[model samples]
Target: MLLEDMLNHQTKIPTEWHTSIRKVGQKFDSAAEVRLALQYYSIAKRFEYDFYHNEQRHIRVYCRFKHTHGCPWMLFASPLRNLSIMSIKNFESTHTCGQHGENAGNLRASRKFIASQIQAVLKVRSDLRAVDIKNDMLSNFSIKINYSKAYESMVHATNTGSRVVIDADDRRFRRLFISYNAYIEGFIARCRPLLFLDGTFIKDRYRGILLSATGENPYQPPHRLIVISDADKGIRATIEEFFPDAFHSRCVLHLVENFKKNMKDFGHKTNVATTLDELLQSAAYKFTISE
Candidate 1:
């Protein structure tokens, strides 16, 4: 099944691979997209490749054992003329190296891929463990990745929260601060130039901090930032790190809750506590202050 022997045989890819990138002129948004598609195709088919050329202009990958086994598998893609999008130019459907063993798809695992796979789980559970993610990948995707990769993916998913932009490869994940494009646009357009930094301890395996910055929401008109959480030292520190200029305010709701709890602890009657709470709330916002 060597490249030299490929001419004498009628070997070609089977039709069952729904994720195949073999079609010429297949378009993609960027080089990262093309690479990601190739990774998906390889993972789906249980194959591996080495990047022969990976540049801003083009990407060319061949079978990992191309030299040793003379595998004919290869794919090449580049940007179309005067366009930013990439398109597949040439592809060899035959892979002499053949299907790899269990967890072969792990070789193609990237932070972006892992992030995508775990996004659904993250929607339901924030304390998802790296071992659980690793095991899930092995069970669901037939990919056996390192615990570090799983941890990094978990961190990236939690920080980015519904946003993911894969940069380069797994080893060189572009470090970033979190901001959605829509949020940035809203802040630049209708919102004031202020941020409300806050944090809550994640009930996670690592028991880490969940730092956040909030401004006027997308649906709202011009408004000020509001930090809504129980006042914790973590929020003060986080604001110092991410938004040093913005003032941190304790949430009034949390303060009210604490007041009620303290009243109960002091053996105050329920009716008395309720009357005091109502008084505080009505007097709390008599004058207009930025919430």
Candidate 2:
């Protein structure tokens, strides 16, 4: 049987459970504790919160059958003594109706929960497809979600809450630029004044180039400068126009690949190409003209 099955059993509430009015005197440090208490009630009674309000000084939560109107299950909490510490003031754990259907459905499908599930998968494989996400959710949680829901969940999961600036021609995507917040920009200003510019072709249906600008920090990983169009001339002109003071350089691996392609196009023999490739690599590694 599924975990949901075990949780949905309508067993009698344990006498030692914390839902009794006696526990009302207990103090909760945060809203999470209040929610956990409600969740414990949910597990014991096989019902879930249909609505919840988290305010500055109090929290109100209501529980009912999934997709149904009010069914008399509710919980309310308020800050005790301290504004940050919440305590459950009132709760009605018993449901008027029997377990409505076996599946949790919308009860377990909060936006935050959906976003968390999407983010967990993306942390391991960023390239996972929408259909794959739908299938994964169904197989793992027994929840079937549509493509739009899955896509929206991914967007919500990845959004950094920063204003993203995109430049396009007649709404046809031309360039996408992202600016760091003021704090991050200030940190980047103190880093080494070097910019690494690189471009790779996007392998999507409407293929285009992805141009990236990155800068190195003193004791941390490189910081992204911007994302722009892949047109080489446009990229150079933009860089020169906006960031003229920074020294720019191409990625060595990309440059070597271009060199190898040119050599192969010239019909150079395998031994000649190998020798030239080795020499080019050595020259690239040299730090100064004398070396």
Candidate 3:
């Protein structure tokens, strides 16, 4: 009857749609029925204005649909809008940084907890790494992470490890690194006038350099690991870039060790060490060293 009424109307649907209108939502229905049903729904739901032009207006429609679904697992609606808008770099620039910043924090904490859970698995079956870190691979971890209430506090609000390691090389990681740099540099700035500089050659098959600086208590010792970087122009640049006011000094023991490695003569080592000590102790050397 509904089909007869639809056919009799002057608003002619294609003849190909001879099937009943009740079955219109099914995919096996005729293409004309599908098309006519879509048209009917578009007009009745006031989606006609949205149908032609890439359905940009359906973004709001999707949001409403998501709200109606009331299932958090159904993140398809949220991701659909995001994936569509992803091509427009300008649309992403505003919110992407903030979203990734929050995600970075969440990832950091998650990765740490993940590692702990994985360690427990490793104790039982150390070969789990060969398998991917999917839910199956990490079933033990997920159980602890998801089910146990006591383990919840271990999850920090801002977990970076999960975000970066799982999604390494992601654009969001790049943005997150920027925010991390800002945070660290701000922290380093607060403890001015004391800088501890040390560099070491990387070991293993490949050799590189690692250098770091931290606030030193003239009385006791520094509390935080202020900075760590390669002993190269990069580390120098970071120092010149971030901690402009702090005093610079090498770890005396490491310097002496390096001197011993390079120089054979003990007398020459003593003279070199003395000269370095004199230069560093002098007021003229303050704020003049590169790092």
Candidate 4:
């Protein structure tokens, strides 16, 4: 399923999750904990705030519009008894401005906040794309975020003690090639004189069109080395230039697809293309020079 759709299909809240009740004298283990609760409150309530004062011992925040609108809403928390045990010293939960959905952009929908919100989805679908997360937030919650934030959000959500690593320089999913040494070694040992090259479109998140080369040795004696692939000019040129002695051939599957495409463009019936494709495939496999 698409990540955006998967996100919309919600699940029951886990036991570890809990909503915060902002009240005076309410204590938290640390200032980070208190800020997280405030973050939850701001996003859920669709409001925004600015940190007026944030220190090791204390943290204070006022409405983001406090300066322009003269809003008086503010909250303050500080270490009460233990240095790390923070307690809410003051909580004024009132907003003068119309806290609309647009406020759920910028600071309100921080990357960390985005990470926390999508962490559950990541657990189930690690291959979830950043764009899908961005779409889900906008469509469902009216939150606007950039692609970089979405990408970093996934990294932060999955990187802690996890192996899913994302390296982004300009905040884009770049090219990649995957191979296994054991498979390569096995192919070499088998001494297959034919190599099959193919590319498949990746539909999943971070799935890019990638070309792969592999060989399988048949029981028959080796002839001149042959390379087969879909008719990509780059592959064709490389094969002809590098291995001049080897014979290069187009993959049979690509030829079949091309035939179907040409028939489709000419307004041929579906069965006509299918019948022709079957005929071509049968002719290719049915007879050999020995026969």
- The model with the greatest lDDT is 4
lDDT by residue for model 2 (1-291), tens:
354455444343343332432345567778776665554445343455655656755777675552475467666788776478877788665555555444543355544456766787799898988688777766655555765556556655776333345565764667665544443465455655455667779998978877665655563446445333333677678787887654445556666767777898999987788788888888989999988
Ranking by TM-score: 1, 4, 2, 3
Clashing pairs in 1: none
1-291: candidate 3 lDDT, tens digit per residue: 443353234133223322222221123223333334333332222211111222322211111222344312110111123232211111110111111111122212233434543454455664543233344322422221222211222221132322121122533322111123333544455543345556667797656554444554333335433433324466567666777654334444554455554454545566676665555445333565563
TM for every model, in the order presented, reads 0.50, 0.47, 0.28, 0.48
What's the best-to-worst order under lDDT? 4, 1, 2, 3
Error of 4 at 27 (Å): 1.5
User: Number of clashes in every candidate structure?
Assistant: 0, 0, 12, 0
Tell me the lDDT of model 2 at 266: 100
Which runs in model 2 stand beyond 4 Å of their true positions? 1-29, 65-67, 97-101, 105-250, 289-291
Pairwise TM-score winner, candidates 2 and 4:
4
Best by TM-score: 1
Which residue pairs in candidate 4 collide?
none
Q: What lDDT is reached at residue 161 by model 4?
A: 24
Residue 67, model 4: Cα distance from true site in angstroms:
1.7
State the local distance difference test value for candidate 2. Answer: 0.60
Q: What local distance difference test score does each model get?
A: 0.71, 0.60, 0.33, 0.72
